[model samples]
Target: MLAIKGVSRRFGGKTAVADVNLEIAPGAFIGVIGRSGAGKSTLLRMLNRLVDPSEGTISFDGVDVTALRGQALRDWRARCAMIFQQFNLIGRLDVLTNVLMGRLNKVSTASAVLQLWGLEDKAMALAALEQFDIANLAGQRADSLSGGQQQRVAIARALVQEPSIILADEPIASLDPRNTKVVMDALLRINKHFGITVICNLHSLDLARGYCDRLIGMSAGRVVFDGAPAALTADAARDLYGLEAGEVMDADADVKWAGQARPASAAA
Candidate 1:
């Protein structure tokens, strides 16, 4: 459903993403994993046109995303929603109102402003909250909720747009282990049940292996590995992470949380 070819991004003389090519199929759950400064976030931003690539092309469902302008760009962005690591909720607005903000593209600015008084937009917003089990908090301010609740609220907001693809950049970076699992479960459920294409940037190899069907590992400013999670081995991970195989294997409990036994393909 999404294709990125020969995409590159540069900041002054340094390149952040170089010659990256990827194809994400419909209903696929793909994870982009790498160390800091590996260009994972830059690549994700380019996919949604949040950051214009310095070179090459990005197409979504056959339309050249780079070619869109004004209303066309706005519409394209609406179809491809993004979820940030930070909840990005409007602190003063009630949870429902914050979620309703997702539909601002579809409604006039005037109608959006008046949405707080239980209008048709309120109903639409409530429906979105219900999807994430946040309906009970509709009337409460977004800042009043816990981190997990806030993230769910953000996800509901993204869902309100009915996006065909969701780009989440380190969506669990701020959460605790429990909250991380909650957020990841919600994302996986969305992909499995609703068939929305999901591309997540994650730092945890185990989390990527556990939640994503395929993994894309980046090193420096280039894609070093792109394959099934089961295809990532200790040696391959060492190379991707730029460390000794044993060192990479022993780095974090979570990174090795999948189990003592490695997948047969990855073991090879």
Candidate 2:
């Protein structure tokens, strides 16, 4: 379990996140929804220690996240992987090489710097690519692929890390609708099939409703609502966004608001 207690983050004089507390069970697919500058990104960053909280504690199982340093912190980062909106791949590197970077923490610094991957490491990276149906693109440059394909490569890289948790910060924000579906489907598959806990920051309420098992609504750096998608009413959405939920409902026409059980085929 991931436990966050009274967490807060401050940048200069302004607070990015304030007094947040949450207990996330293992294997959960959680969607974090909020308007821009609502501290959604800050919250996720704090989990992986990319950004340290000014106050409170974050724990995974019994480990205290705040006190970790050096190699321990690096190990923690490997366990709690982060997926970014920009896909963060080395544009000039081949897809397979980029995926192999996930093993940096496990390998010696000299070997990693020299790019000396062994046959087993290469096989693991290839297997991760094949799991995402992108093994054929292993030899291709990461920048040469489409947005959806690049994102899949990013996911494959995360898979090679063998993370216990995945924190995606607005992962589909830059993609078109078709690419959005593809990336979201990949995340859903990772969460359901691998039993890895996923917490994604999303701009679209409909996508959150369709893909996430639980929705966490934030407003002005505070959590406003936490529950199932069906329980999030139009009024509650309005609280998150000044605009009514109806205006956003059409963003993804196929996503229903009634919180029906997502079909297995959706992830497949």
Candidate 3:
């Protein structure tokens, strides 16, 4: 569904992403992991044209995404929705209203500003909330919800757009363990049930291994590994993080928010 070839991004002299190549098939759940400055977020943003590549090309369903502009670009972005680490909801708006904002591209700016107060949009928004199990909070202000609830609402908002592909950049970064489970479960369920293509940037290897069908590891702005989650090893992880296998194993045995638990066979 998505293909990135020889993609590179530079901010002035600093290259955030370099010569990255990846292909995502329909209904695939792919996870990207890397250190703080490894360019995972930059790569995710480039998928939907949030950041145009400094060099190389990105294509979606065979259409060259970097070449898109004007209405064409907007239309393409609508098909590939993004979820941020922060739940980017309007604080004052009701949860349902915030979710309905996903449809803004389909409606006029005036209508969206007024929230298109009608039964149809309301029904669609409520259905989206129901999917995320936040239907009861539909009328409440976005700011009133807990972190987990807010994130679920944000997912609902993205789902409301009926996007063919979802790009989530550290979606569960701020949640506790239990909340992380809830959010990851929701994402997994969506991928399994709806067959939506999901590519997410995650910090935790455990979470990526547990939930994603495939993992892509990055270091210093380049992809170092791309394969099934089961293929990852302590040695590979050590190389990715520039640590010894023992050091990587010793630090934080407990699962971090998005961390994956090592499989029995791979455990040290």
Candidate 4:
């Protein structure tokens, strides 16, 4: 289980996430839905130590995740993989190379710096790509692939980390509807098949309802709702998103909360 207790993140004087608490059961698929700047991304980053919380503690199982340092922090990050809105692949490198980068914490610095990955490591990276049905593109440059394909490669990279939890910060924000389905399905498969916990930041209520078993709604950096997807009614969505029933169900409405510019797949 992942436990977040009294967690908060402050940017200068502004609190991005505030006094939040959550318990994530193992292997659960959770979609965190909220307007932009609601601190959805900040919450996920705190789990991976990408950002330190201004207050409170986060623990995985019984380990003190917030206190991890140096090698311990790196190991914690390996155990808790993160995927981002941008694919974050090394654009100049081949897909397989980028996936192999997941093993950096486990491998020697010399080997990584020299790009001297062993044949077994190479095979494992290939296997990860194959798991995502992208093995044939392993030799292709990451920058050459379509957005959906790059996202899959990113997931494959995370899989190579053998993480217990995957925190995806708007993984589908840039993809079209077709690509969104592809990426979301891949994440679902990873969660269900591998028993890896998944916490996703999502923009589309329909997509969140369709994919996540549980939904967490955030507003003003606090969790306003947490329940099964089926319980998120039109009224609940309205409260979460400040949208009326028609706008909530439009499916193609711009949900750029907090006046942020919508992504290319704003209609997603």
In terms of TM-score, the best-performing candidate is 2
Q: What is the per-residue lDDT of model 3 for residues 20-43, given as tens digits with 9 covering 90 to 100?
A: 988889999998987888999999
Instruction: Tell me each candidate's TM-score.
Output: 0.89, 0.94, 0.91, 0.92
Candidate 1: segments with Cα more than 4 A from true spot: 116-120, 244-268
Candidate 2 residues lying further than 4 Å off, grouped into runs, are 244-247, 255-268
lDDT of 2 by residue, 116-159 (tens): 99898999999988888899999999999999999999888888
What's the lDDT of the predicted structure labeled candidate 4?
Answer: 0.89
lDDT of 2 at 53: 97
- What is the C-alpha lDDT profile of model 4 across 148-257, one tens digit per residue? 99999999999999999999999999999778877888898888889999999998787787778889999999999999877988888888888433543545334422
Cα error, candidate 1, residue 31 (Å): 0.3
Per-residue error for 95 in candidate 3, Å, reads 0.3
Q: What is the lDDT of residue 266 in candidate 3?
A: 27
Q: Rank by TM-score, descending?
A: 2, 4, 3, 1
